[model samples]
Target: MIENIPLLVTNISYGVTFIITVGFGLAVYLKSSRKTAHIMFLFLSLAIGIFQICHVFGINVVDGESSRSIFTGSLSVIFVICFTIHWVLAVLEKDSEKIKTIVGFYTVAVGLVVFYLINPSAFLLNSVPKLYLPNYYEAGNYYWLMFVFFTVGALYAFYTLAHAYRIADPAHKNKLRYFMAAIAIGFPLGSTAFFLALNINIDPIYSTLFSIYIIPLAYGTLRYDVMDIKVVTKKAVSYALIIAGIGFFIAGINWADTLIQSVYTWVPIWAIPLTSSILAVFIGGFVWEKMRDIDILKYEFVTVVTHKFRTPLTRIKWASEMLKKLIPVESADQSRLAVDEIDNANGLLVELTDMLVSLRQVDDINYLYSFEESDMCKIVEKAARNMNKHILDKKIDFSLVCADNIPSVMLDARRMQFALQIVIENAVIYTPEEGRVSVSVTQENGKVVVSIIDTGIGISKEDIDHIFTKFFRSKEAKTTDTEGMGIGLFMAHQIIERHDGDMSVSSDGIGHGSMFKIEVPKA
Candidate 1:
């Protein structure tokens, strides 16, 4: 039994690694099976899983049979590299014909390596028990060539990822960062096994720790929009933890029975099943809670969408009826009035559509942004100009002041304009007619700041905290603007955040007016 300790430990490590990689791969594939990148990710995971499982058997089998298992595990490395390169290219949106050609050439090289691997004599000399490992193999004449192939493939994949990260937009850059981090941690550590294969005396403990990569990979998946999956909630994380805990608990009991049968004899066998049943109950409750939360979110989303779209749709229908009545007989003024009403209704529909699109994009990993150095003053002026009609219609006392020689900031101009327009338009809409509305641009503390102050129905203290939440309307806002869908501010906030900027609002209370400030770092 004491002699079996190393084999047991090694099996446990490889077994856990196999489960994690395959589990993540399946999750991603189930979420989006059609995506090329996701498919490649699954293949990579399977390759790793195969490599780990092969090692588990290779280390436990008799020395005479170990050579085949180790050789198969070594062969899996080629697939790992192939899948990694394809996955990286797909994720980075570099899947062009030229890239395919390059990948094909790499595949040819991998094929040659496989040809060499098929004849065990070419890649493996023999297997012998070594320091900690149950079976460690010595390298043959061509083993160095396999290592070179693996090294070159890894370097190329890393290079591709790094180069793409440098040029990727903010959102894509964030996703790539997670992938790069995982590679940085896992690949090099796992490569330590190769040193042992070459007859070096180095311990292969780092190879067992390769599973540590899942930490960052899992975190990136849950915390960010990765592989087109939205951010998972804490409840989801709790569910995963509970499941993993149960698995570990059961495995622990079995391992204890095997390793310490004399001590485990006192423990009742029924106790294990009872504890597992309790855990199952806990999981069920947790899953129910998550389901309830999802249901509530869906209901709220539908309510907002339907409530917001109904008004413009009704108006459009009414205008069409009026247009039909005014056909071919009335004065030009009447016909023009109907056409204008239809046009206004259409404009409202377009605005609503744009808002919905922005809402959808806010949490998307693939949202594209084009950043360039831009003038804060010009962007502010443009937004104000766009809201000119609203200002005139409300007859609000509007003023604009811009500081000269303001430093340019790097931002997506169109998105910045949209964000500013939302604030200015809200100021115009919420403030009573003849109330004051002011826009100003200045630089402060290495950042360009845009401020919009208005004598509007000011935000109450209770509502201020939730102002940027999607579909959340303050009591005063609901009373003042029944048509508001409560998405503009949320969209604006997301845009500013993506630009490495922040937005803040201050209000004295419900009738004291409010001020909104946006700050972006200077280019």
Candidate 2:
């Protein structure tokens, strides 16, 4: 029993590694499969899981079969390296064509290595029982080639990440640093298995702890917003506590079953599992209902608070208007300026109140919307005119173009104008002084298409997908507009979707520009 302890511990390490790698990979993939980085991570995780499984079985298999099992597992390393490169490039937002070209070359090379690995004789001589691992394989003629391939590929990935980190912005640099640290710890330690293959006789204690890197990797990815994963802290903690409770419950059942069996030997074995299953269902349903109730309460609280804000905002607006009227045009410039400041402050407060109301309505299932046929050009023009003050303040080169034959669209006129204003406002706020903002209204494919383009701090590829997500703000966006709530686009998108229209945005990356297109069906 004592002699088997090392094998047991090693197997446990592999098992834990497999669970964590696959779990995170699946979680990320399920969250956003369209992202190339997520997909590559999933593939890489499966490769690692397969390798671990093979090793787990290889260590327990007969000596004659052990070599084949371990060697077959070795084939997965090629895929691991290939997918790692792809994942890194994707995360770094490398040029798509360049990523394809580089990853394609590695893929072809991996295919060749996979074919070579199939004939184990090309890379493995034989297997021998070792101190830590149950079976350690001896290197054959071309085994060095495997090491070379892995080393070269891993080094290249590390180099790329290091280079990116050096020149990356503050936010991106932190994420890259986390990734680099994780791989730096995981790869080198895990590669100790290669030393064993070369018959160096070193025990792979480091391999047993290789999965430790996942801690930093997961933290960086989730906490730093590496991908567009929106993790609600409350939900995550609640679920974690629930899962822990269930685990404790299961253990308690087992303990009780053992105690009962000791006291009454005739009790049927099926009773414990059956009783536990029923109790689990009951508890799960109870927890789910409670969670739903909590959501309802949260929404209700927000609704009440949002409604309460309207009264003060209206009074402020009225007071500001009165002040503006009381101040004569021929009076001191300071008096006029003071009134203007008050009006501006009031306007900002009103806009915030409106945004809050809209946010509340978005969560209200029974909120009614009035839809009518409204001229798209007029709506666009109105939104632009409303932002004229901002345009003049920034000295922006703003232009509006309306097609002569533009069609009217079915929309809630007030909501649609609000949505348009949100998009136009973002354009004005984000663009630097003297930058250009253009709005065009035209009819295309039986739909009214409104395009708003701006020269601003453009959205990154990663952020563009999540720009419309509630409370999601890009690093640059946050820096550019410190007072932005990050909900305008989200509310606007929701409003447009309710009108059976579509909203989309494109950017040529940061410091370039952005284009937002809204399409609504013609009435």
Best prediction by TM-score? 2
The TM-scores, one per candidate, come to 0.52, 0.54
Model 2 TM-score, 2 decimals: 0.54
Off by over 4 Å in 1: 66-73, 97-101, 167-173, 214-223, 226-523
| lDDT of candidate 1 over 1-523, digit per residue (tens) | 3776766777777766666676666566544454677788778777776677667667655664555556567577777778778877776657663486457847766776667757767777667777776677677777777778777777887888899889874535666788788888788888888898887877776687775675555445433333223433333344444555665576565556555546668777666666666766786788778877986786578557766786667778687777767675456655655565565546545555655655545544676678999898998998788666667778899999999889999988977888898899899989999999999999999999999999989987767766776667888899999999887887788789779788988898899899999999999
lDDT at 358 for candidate 1?
58
Summed over model 2, clashes come to 0
Stretch of 10 with least lDDT, candidate 1:
224-233
Which lDDT tens digits does candidate 2 get at residues 123-209?
A: 776677776665766677777777787788778888989999989855467778888998888888878988887778777766755
Top of the candidates by lDDT: 2
